[model samples]
Target chain A: MKKFISVLMSALIVGTSVFMLSGCGNGEKQQELNVFNWGEYISNGEDGTIDTIREFENRYNVKVNYTNYESNEEMYNLIKESNSSYDVIVPSDYMISKLIKEDMLEKINFDNVPNFANIMEKYKKTDFDPTGEYSVPYDWGVVALVYNKTMVKEKPKSFSVLWDKQYSGNILMFNNSRDAMAIAMRLKGINPTEITKKDIDVASAYLKEQKPLLKKYVMDQVFTEMEGDQAAMAPYYAGDVAVMMSNNENLDYMLPEEGSNWFMDSMCIPKTTQNKELAEKFINFMLEPEIGKANIEYLGYSTPNQKVYDLLDEDVKNNELNYPKEEYLKKCYTFSDLPQDVYDYMQEEFLKVQA
Target chain B: MKSKAPSIPYLIWMLLFTIIPLIMVIYYAFTDKSGNFTIQTFKDSLFYTDVFIRSLWIALVSTLLCLVLAYPLSYVMSRSSRRGQNILTMLIMLPMWMNFILRIYAWVLLLQNDGLIDLAVKFLGLDVPLLGNAGAVILGMVYNYLPFMILPIHAVMLKIDNSLIEASKDLGANKFNVFRKVVFPLSIPGIISGTTMVFVPTASTFLVAQYLGGTGDKMIGDVIENIFQRDKNVGSAISLVLMVIILLFIIVMNKFGDEEVVA
Candidate 1:
């Protein structure tokens, strides 16, 4: 009788151990989807507002593990190196092309995302995704001039202001190659995407000359630098311009007459993602008018969702930075992925300047 | 009598973490396609311009800064009362105990224009651009590694015989002469160890450079990081080249340093 009891007890212990291990394993896999996006670009849905992720969680019964990357290049490298199973990635237009060319992204199925119809008519069928097959537009904005009124005597409207000798040592330009090149290209009245040896040389010369004038080349943190009043002026994303203006009364956002770069950051699934269905659900959840509007309002970017735009507050809808006049739109250019060889050449030249 | 060798499990752990990674790096250094090994990978990275020279310069600067700032503080601590020494040592090491990334972030806040230091400058009516420059990167490197320098020098100083200093003084050596001839000579090992500790890590750390440095402040670590993280290169080749660079640096420094010791 005692031997029988010992065997029974051992069997029960084994059963419990198996049960615990299985429970932990399944729990980890069942409700988890990893999201990689820009930092501070999402709402956490606290303070009685519905965050997009919370909406996804409620409908899909999946927990979202959100992470942020500061730049598209950082995101691309990370996803390439590690077996990163990020279900969703947000990258800009040019980056999407790069990823697609490299076969890094999965061709998204729109059938799973019924809310794609809600996107603005213009945002659809962009050069980056000809068929609109791989990506869903998230937020779109222009990179425009943001300056401190208190520092400048005259209101600056042209990209020429960046090259002004008077503003030397007080001006801040974007440190990124693409953004900086875009500004220079527009000022020279050259096509940003078209690669000519002379065009690049001119841009390089312009940059070298501007180097002395610049306090520093900055990226996302340019806003903080501007807020600190270190830079009298900078070329920054329009959405960030609004945020800076709201906080500091001295700041003003301007749409440069020389044109600016128009960017659309989209959400796409990589081929490496293990959770395709869940990713589609989350993408669709983000497209919901309310969810999209909330993100745009909270993050202070222009929404790509037409439904969301109609729902925006009157002030936001009327903001010139968010919706500039049609003439300004004509001057703006959208960046396309350069030929790999051209990109390599540009990278070498950029390093040369540093060297 | 047979003594059982260390269990196979213990041997396996060391081989898995240390030996295998080293082997993989060496193997990948030679390979191409960002993954499978080839000789081209090694050649490409090796030929990459000024990677070795820039790394050496930065490391040397950081090491010199560590030595200058730490030696006096450590000496002072060694001369203090036991309780005071303990307190001072803790204070010096306190920053080290915090997360490395957090410490860097603090430097960012402190160095940025309109940061704490900048605000102080403004309050005093002075124009200053201490943040986002080469000066800030060097300052940060010294700040982070100062404790490493101090602790080693302090340990060596505490081990020092007090009678030696008394003997020097008895022979009519002044304070400066005593320090140069007696205390300094005795502290060579500590200096070398401290310099090595500070130099190696500061040279490899790109975070401070990325945050505080401007365009001109790009370091060897940043280049390696760009190749691995930005370019999405398999990084095996970069790793291999970096190892070679570091090995050559250490060897050259050791030869020069040993000669200095002998002279």
Candidate 2:
């Protein structure tokens, strides 16, 4: 029996390796375009529905290789390693800035992307890539409080509510350094874009005090925690807030009066990519009003394209989560690139708080 | 002398798959971003005390749970009829035949707040979150590695002499006493092998902790993976520290295990 089990284990390792290696070599050679983006953030032909990549593949005879990363950092590392030549990448505002500064992105030929006109005026230029050089806006959303109306007596109006001891073990916060720091910065009346090392240290201590009260630190799936009543309130992307509220009647979203991180995910070509034209074509196809609208509607995120935004359903257009009022926008700020020293300090503080 | 060394193919395979990769990891652990050799990377990773402690705790708990659950199951299989033994063994090995990733996905489907378990609870009119806790992490680790525990213990049990057990019974020793005095002590080798097998992989596995476990439940595997994938060579250094700790654990376990036998 002992010899048999050892033999079986050895056989499994060998057999699995052989099978994996066999699959490796047969990858078809074609005019291929690779894309890296967030999971569940794009339509993938579920239930026979037409998806974005499927449309691109059918129209341009180019094989599309779509992969996902849980966070922007994960995507950055893959592009940084292996020279895999990802033709298109969707990264948030600050990351787009970092990539450009590192010279890892290709300059966009706006002439090739005629559909750039569809983009809303507000999302056209930003502190990151301010010249509109490398990236095209994909979607925009805010990080806001997703709360259970039934669990809490009063509505959460500020980031301070998440820190309140009354809701001990009932709050969830973002796990990312930027999102976590943004909330603490907003609460203290500090602009997230210009956060200093001292500010991060203060935020770190503030978060550490709040940690015992927090049910957990969450990322993209903050809604799951809120909907299940595991946490009474969590910081979540605005689009997800709408989905959680709709799916669970007990839940609701509030754009904190003190504001939160507002972000735009944009598509950019990596410098290592060989097929630049195919990359530009894919970007343009995504920008088509109908294509853009379908993605926005399917994914529940706000569209950067004005045509797509106009074509959205009445509920989506009116959904406060998708389109907050101007007063709310006044308090919000886009994340900007922090200096290396400040970033290092934030990373250190984040580690301490997590511990 | 009919002695001949193992074939070149076998040695080459081991070198390429295991030895070379291990060396690469160690090499990366020392190198900085500019590809220059540096000890600063090692110095940087020493600060991640949380990741190391959390991973160790999770692996320790999971190993304990596997041991507790596996002992009885292996005992039953060993003592059962041949036909029953074969059938039970097959069933135990069947879940592992599927892809590890697929098994994780199945667990996700079953454990999601809106998933099968939740639906069943709702049908029975109860509300509870069983999917995201220390309990769930244990369940996943056990579910993935129970076969490892069972097979080793069953091997040891199969090799156990029946006469010794019969004599213990004839000496007025109850079943519980017989198990405690004879069966449990004799199965130490199996326990060590199974524990090591279950503990090491469970410690290094990131997917289970990242997906099934909750926020505070984050393990060292997740941290190492986050660092490695994010191009933080410092994370590789942290991993090297973890590897050293695991090596020390094995050495300690072996020393104590031998000491116990001698005593």
Candidate 3:
């Protein structure tokens, strides 16, 4: 145990110190574009899919320095705290809005990114970026309640099913405060947007009431539990649900008619970009139809680009679980950046529920 | 003066890495997010009393279990021939060589519903839920830290002068009195250190509970980790409190160990 803690500490120290160091080596005349994205977010030539970064590098005669962050907070901290220069980043909608509020994102010059017009109109003027100036939508997904059909005798159509006493010790819920509290807020008929302390108290009450029934407050572990048939039900992202179903034939999913949280991850250049035009060109390259299709298919998420949607495999394009219909999407809500105090209150109250 | 020169590099390393980070933790604990002085961070951490209690309880249980299991085994290993001691030492250390996360995940696979352990329980006509409980979390902590307990006690017992036990016997002490009056007292330092080693980490570490425990089994470490991502002030405050609790625990343990041996 001591060894594990020491290992974790040294690893975190090394990771942060290394991140703070600005490596300015681009070699002889090869312009470097630093692209920071979520891990496993892009296709990298495996299974005959396009190696998007390699293709970009080879085509433009530029070296693409790629790095990955697991969460928006980590990425935000790196950019805020370090001299590490990243030209491009893929942050989710609320995070993009936060960065925009902080004036950390650079506006994309649409002339350099002609393919911006290919993205669906709805994704362009999203709640997170009303003017669509700071970011271009890359992918979108909604929360889905996935269940092992063998364990759940009835098809679960509502979030209320998660609180059922019958499913005690078999239900997995989100471990993160935002998702967990948002879902709880929704179940209480309160809008998940513009959260308040009163709303948090109410949501936390519901979570506390249901804590006994939860197998675990899980993030990635939901995949193992649901696939292994150790859990009867779990609420997870639509993209990951598709991944889980592929692993376990006993699993199926529903969009929950009441409502669910929707998330959109968009690509944007930070305000600190060294080469703005190159960043914009790289973003445009990502929006290319074939590249977008391969990337979206490999990632198992719904693409915001119309050309990519049209180019998708017939079976993938038709999979409603991965791409919920527009009407069901109407009920889906996207989280915008909350007031800091309210956000902190929500986190504290969520911890209290677990406590 | 000679020690100071040899320790210069370590002292500098501690000042830069440990002391600075610790001071920052204190700074965060006493301040608000905007860098204003406040105790609100500590006040908010009060909401996590239940988690703190649970963490301490789990840690205590794990430590006691390690002591109970390790004491007799260490005693036997100390009494064994040198060859036997070597083999036993090797066996205790073998599992620690494997990746920590892998071992925890293996426990998850073995204890979850219809898992190997659960299957055997079912075959015995039992319907007990094996995973997602405090018992599972405690089991994980005990398994991971037992070797720490055994090795320390074993090392101390091996150092006991053979003449002491013989002297106690010569004084008309039987087997039980010789062990009680001689071998055990001499081994108290090892027991104290072993207890410290097992209990401190068990109380603080979070991942074991995450993998093996249910939602209700959350520890202070888990809460600290989750809250740290959002509010570093409150996280630091909670961490400060946990450290104080652990410090108090160690002080108490040392006092008790001294009293036991001195008596």
Please give the RMSD of candidate 1 to the true structure: 5.8
Misplaced by over 4 Å in model 3 are A1-28, B1-3
Worst 10 residues of 1 chain A by lDDT: A346-355
Candidate 1 per-residue lDDT, tens place, A312-350, comes to 989889888998877888888998888765765565555
* Order of quality (DockQ): 3, 1, 2
Best by DockQ: 3
Whose TM-score is greatest here? 3
- Write down the worst ten-residue block by lDDT for model 3 chain A: A19-28
Error at B76, model 3, angstroms = 1.7
Error of 1 at B130 (Å): 2.9
Q: Model 1 reproduces what portion of true contacts?
A: 0.31
Better of 1 and 3 by TM-score: 3
lDDT (CA) for every model shown? Answer: 0.80, 0.82, 0.91
The DockQ values of the predictions, listed in order, are 0.26, 0.17, 0.61
Alpha-carbon runs more than 4 Å astray in model 2: A1-36, A43-50, A56-70, A273-278, B1-7, B28-58, B94-144, B167-185, B202-216, B230-233, B259-263
State the lDDT at B92 in candidate 2. Answer: 93
Second chain alone, TM-score for each candidate: 0.85, 0.90, 0.97
The parts of candidate 1 lying over 4 Å away from their true place are: A1-36, A60-70, A73-89, A98-114, A194-201, A269-281, B1-62, B101-128, B167-181, B230-263
